[model samples]
Target: MEFSHRDDHNNLSLTRFESMLKTNNVLFFDSNEFENIIQHYLENGKIALAKKAIKMGLQQHPSSTNLRLYKTEICILENDLEKAEEILDELYELEPSNEEIYIQKASILSKKDQHQQAINALMIALEFTEDQDDDADLFSLIGMEYLFLEKYADALSYFEKCLEIDMHDYSALYNIIFCFDYLNKNKEAINFLNNYLDENPYCEVAWHQLGLQFTSLKEWKKALAAFDFAIISDDTFVGAYLEKGKVLEKLKCYNEAIEFYEMTLTLDEPTSFALLRIGHCHEKMGNLDLAVDFYYKTVHEDPLLDKGWIAITKFYNRSKNYQKALYYINKAINIDCENVAYWKLYAVINHRLNFLEEAEVGYKKSLDYGNYELETWISRADILTNLGEYEASIINLMQAAEFYPENAEIEYRLAGLNFMVQQNEKGIFHLKNGVLINQEYQFIIKELFPSITELQAVKNIIAVTEKS
Candidate 1:
């Protein structure tokens, strides 16, 4: 159904339904109209209204098999599976040839995670289905049941059956691709889709799936060609445009990528994803001002998009504009306070601006949010040391050493912090271990703690470790 036509019909039906409900009159609707009304309520999650509609429908047409099936559906939705099964059994006796009865029974089984039984039910449904066009739907249902069981090969076989019956069964095609991808048979998927496209050359979905397979193989040029074919098959295929833009970006064709990304905005409303990609491309091309503009646009379009704020913050940080970076990063933290990366960036920016207290708070927040990186701990300790909190710095580095036992940099920093705190024996012990692990890290100590090099004992230790 076209969306506009469906929307207009639904609106008219809903308005009439509402008017009838308000007037409390005998609602004059045929069996099909009542079914549509009940279905609309069910689809919109207005379960109470759906129940009312079903009751009124049954009153108007007590022998409606469709309404009885819908009642069984309502029972299933309420998780009264036993009641639903009873209704399905009664309906089966009444209409032995009804495909909908078996389908509903399969749905109930599926709800209980009895996927094999669901497949059996759908297979029986296939036996009863008189319409050839309904075979595709039945095949797709069986495919889904097999999928639920993680039987990808069986699922793909049934989905392929569906595609054979209905060449326009894009859902079946997608399922086939999914099965192949899950089974790590991308090569087979590519071959299958290629063969399918040869017969159904205008299948945009098949072309899109072929493009995705090529992308998985890292064949950027082939992926682009497939995506182009998909776009040619369906000019308004947004997914093709987005994917083509991604491939262009991967190939470093920024200008062409931007054009495709911009084209999506013309076809549909501006999306944060598209805007963010455009900003990233501009940033890559050294257009900082344009990148910042798009990044701002992205956040304005969707304030909840943390990546937009992060991108803007990173751009300003790269330009050494600490204040602006802090502002944007704080916005990101507000949106997702538990995000570890955001807190880490906040800490780094505050440290750069020499806000020692705020930096330490941010660093602790990062750790609290599960940042296990050795660098985070090391940087936090450095900040503490700069604040004349030598003992605190030693404690932090000790924890860092535990996290990365073989890291020479952490050991060296631990040695320097111990020396600063006048723990000579501990300092010497750590220095020896640091040197033994990676003697090259001695340069870090020299650069970071030049005053420590003046100590004769430290100089002797370094010289002896180097010779050894």
Candidate 2:
């Protein structure tokens, strides 16, 4: 707030400073006026101007503490840590009780990746801080230092101290909740938030955090109550409205979820999240036309939203509209080429439309992208067999067997494919393995490869297994 006693005085300092810079005039200013000019440059992010002001201000007033402090701050911002430290060491000799000196020392230590040492410097700063608000600020700095050390419990304690000084400090409140969440202490977090609400009942952020904690515990009804309280505290809170909608949806109150979701549209701008939720609610309620409409709107509002395209494709796919489903899925794939879910759905749609080659490519991509679902493995194996790639089918099933060794279905598939390729010994071995896993699935042998069932070894194995 330098030169802040009057608006015209503040304007006059900046104007005269800039005029002197352009004219190369050796103009004189008092130490306080130089500070006002330098502060204006610093606050506006005009670092070069601030530096020039510092040089001139120092030459004019050789012993100004504020001017020297500003120079040290510039050095810190520019990462000239050595020079910054030299200035600070000099300043410390002058004013040993200056908290800003210690704070800047903490900043320099932090930049050197010395988080524990930074915390130590901040603790010294705390000893010198006389103002209650400055103490809270220093506490936040120490809490951040603990966070950088991955010491969540220590960070939480300091942030809690910050809240004790100023109950309305939202940043401290958020940091405290983040620590609780990182420690996975949901129950403890709920108790803490409940205590906080007792003191500051209208804190919507606390209520919102309480709701999220209850949601994580799967206490859906309790989460709904918490979100309701958040809305009561701040009706315009978009996060509360969205979370309430989700909780209602989880409770299968689809229509009620839709009501709250629509309210969000009026309170905020059109969001793809709200539109997507409304589409899901419509789909759950069997309103197919309305469901598709909202899904389309979801994609239109946010073209990169893959879930919206997926919803549209799923809706059409369920209606046996293979072509429509494939069209929407293509859009999703174009946006995110490596998305496993998109490629998996693309394979399903293309297979339904009898595009076997492209369907096989899609399945291959889904597997390549880490979609290791058992169904994906079997589906790709089946597609390989259809394309007359029997050896590839065997290899696919063998890989799946590695992931799911005890599955009788994969064992049976391996048995049939091995026999189809005239690998008789492997076929008989897999047949016995499959029957031992589940004799009820011998139909896999009899139905898919009937000739294998007629073999003496196959019949004998099944007979012995059934008796056992």
| Best-fitting candidate, scored by lDDT | 2
Work out the TM-score per prediction. 0.77, 0.78
RMSD of each: 4.8, 4.6
lDDT of 2 by residue, 184-261 (tens): 999999999999999999899999999999999999989999999999999999999999999899989999999999
Clashing pairs in 2: none
Identify the runs in model 1 with alpha carbons over 4 angstroms from their true place: 1-20, 27-33, 43-46, 60-65, 78-86, 89-99, 367-371, 381-468
Error of model 1, residue 181, in angstroms: 2.7
Off by over 4 Å in 2: 1-131, 145-150, 217-222, 398-402, 405-407, 418-463
**lDDT for each of the candidates?**
0.89, 0.91
Tens digit of per-residue lDDT, candidate 1, span 1-468: 112355876667667877888896776677887788888788778899989889888999999999999999999989999999998898889899898999999999999999999988888899998888899889998999999999999999999998898888888888999999999999999999989988999989999999999999999999999999999999999999999999999999999999999999999999998999999999899998899999999999998888888899999999999999999999898888888889989999999999989999999898888897987898888888778898988888888778899789988888887887788889998898988899989987787777898887799998897678
